[model samples]
Target: MKGWRARLGFLVPPGNPTVEPEMQALAPQGVSLHFTRMTASGPAGTHEGQEERNRSQIDSIESCSALLAMVSPQVIVMAHTATSYTLGSAAEAALVARIEQLSGTRFITAFGSVLAALEHLNVRRIAYATPYNEVTTLQGKRHLEEQGIEVVSYGQLANVRNIYEENDERAYAIARAVDRPDADAVFLSGVGMPTLDALQVLENDLGKPVISAASAMMWNALRVAGVQHSHSGYGRLLS
Candidate 1:
């Protein structure tokens, strides 16, 4: 329960049920995780609803961050990956910097972390999968492309009401369905998806790196917090 090395604070969407558990499973011995929810509502089944929910939740970051700051965490993570599309890369960087200044903590976003993880593994072309409608999936793909990563193939579990409730088997299936032989890696987007249990298997079966939103977030948070422990059972990104 003691954070001997560093404590990490997470800002998650209100209805999300996966971020806390997944991040906790990924944390190292000396690291601890704390979470705060951002206000949001509506179904995640449709792109319009998802956008509304994301906007509503992101509006609460400033206030929620203020509360998390009182805990004095070494790092704060923005756990909602979809918000990165709301603000482009440059704008998102500025927003993170602003939050850091306000909270006096280093910050990492899910999208940014995924990008870093891909770059770290020298993965240029990726097969992307998400538990979202086609519209939201395309937005995520566009965002990645704008960041200079190629999305050679993609798939989605369209009309998913609650991504957190998705099973590990489905996550693996989606990743496999989208993957191509030419892709350097496979990316499973969304922190809400239960991806940790499937990451290692996917990588082993595909013979390449596999990265997920939750794994990427944890890796980046640990790196930023100076926790050098390399974890196994998730994937090569964390190991």
Candidate 2:
């Protein structure tokens, strides 16, 4: 198949079962999404375990990203949102810079992409939802605040061992639960949580823009790749 627009390289955490399918579902025609997994181990939902898993990804990113560079993808997307929190915004930016320097490709993380999306939508106050432990969720909240977005309300499906196991209904419920009347947008964090299926529903119900890690990743990947296409059914960021 001819990739007339661009080829996207995605780096996802090992054992994640949702990012690939979710990204593919949001990709526009003429755009191709390729993925490689970083090394990660240990039980999920524990702070030490999550840190170890993130460390594995950080340790293995160079080699894994090098492999993706071989395809000459226009943009590289770090599909793990928690990695940004694990490394903090500054460290994560440095890590992305290093990856770009090594791979000779531009890079975007799920967290970074979501921030850009929120800015693009002019959303200052947002209600956030995530399928992470309290520690990771707090990190995400801090990262968002550093970007100048106010998190008016926040909720999490705490202690979820595998975010991919969450169904769309659960995702919708979380978004609805986290939404606040003062929020300009609803941000559903965690790329591994199935969210595309509920994006439109959430937007309609909340009467506000809805953004998810997966949706923002796809939108940012397309924009960074110079593909000026807009997709429907996801949210205003894409459409």
Candidate 3:
């Protein structure tokens, strides 16, 4: 309602608890974020049966559409990176398009944001770290490779369910473990995995750029909200 203030609505899995604060921490001035949880029946706090977990996710888009309608945000962000990364770009884009057609609003997902960020940096090589099962993690790597970015290395944490249960420590540990000397950048996938607190430190320690799903989500959302996108001490996407 205010010119300087823009509202961003995020649709996340019910099991996810990391998107909010991580995105919030990266939000630029004059932008506010809100969230809507969709059905996410899974192991609850670990990265287990991803196929079953994402099945619930596929069923939740309509609910996400409904939530988008209620929020009337300038843009809706699909806050889970795994879905987009594992589902492939076409599937992710189709979901965003479906939600946009349903709600007459635009949307972006974590994969979309990461893709955009990578393009902005002109990077064609990357390494990834994920707290997803092996199946999902490989799917993510394949998804990125399909986009023409060479996957130099990857690390999988195989965490199965909830994100709050997997906190900053896990992210930091995985980040340090996943950094590859040959990769142009390191990607910490999944907004629910909590990487904002570890991203900068990882960059400092690794001496390379790092990008997280949570950070990318905030960057893209802010651009959609018409905010001046700039930040210091983060990654190249914002800096």
TM-score of 1: 0.95
Clashes of each: 0, 0, 8
Q: Rate the local accuracy (lDDT) of all candidates.
A: 0.87, 0.87, 0.78
- Indicate the residue-level lDDT of 21 in model 1: 85
Query: Tens digits of per-residue lDDT for model 1 on 136-207?
Result: 888899999999999999999855667767889999999999999999999998888889999999989999
Model 1 residue 169 lDDT? Answer: 93
After superposing candidate 1 on the true structure, give the runs of residues whose Cα lies further than 4 Å from its correct spot. Answer: 1-3, 43-48
Worst 10 residues of 3 by lDDT: 156-165
Give stretches of model 2 more than 4 Å off: 1-3, 44-48, 158-161
lDDT of 2 by residue, 119-234 (tens): 89988999999988788899899999988999999999855657767877889998999998999999998887889989998888878999999999889989999989878887
lDDT of candidate 3 over 174-222, digit per residue (tens): 8778778888888988776777777777778887788988888788888
The lDDT of model 3 is: 0.78
Q: What TM-score does candidate 3 get on C-alpha atoms?
A: 0.91
Q: TM-score, each model? A: 0.95, 0.95, 0.91
What clash count does candidate 2 reach? 0
| Cα displacement (Å) at residue 98, model 3 | 1.5
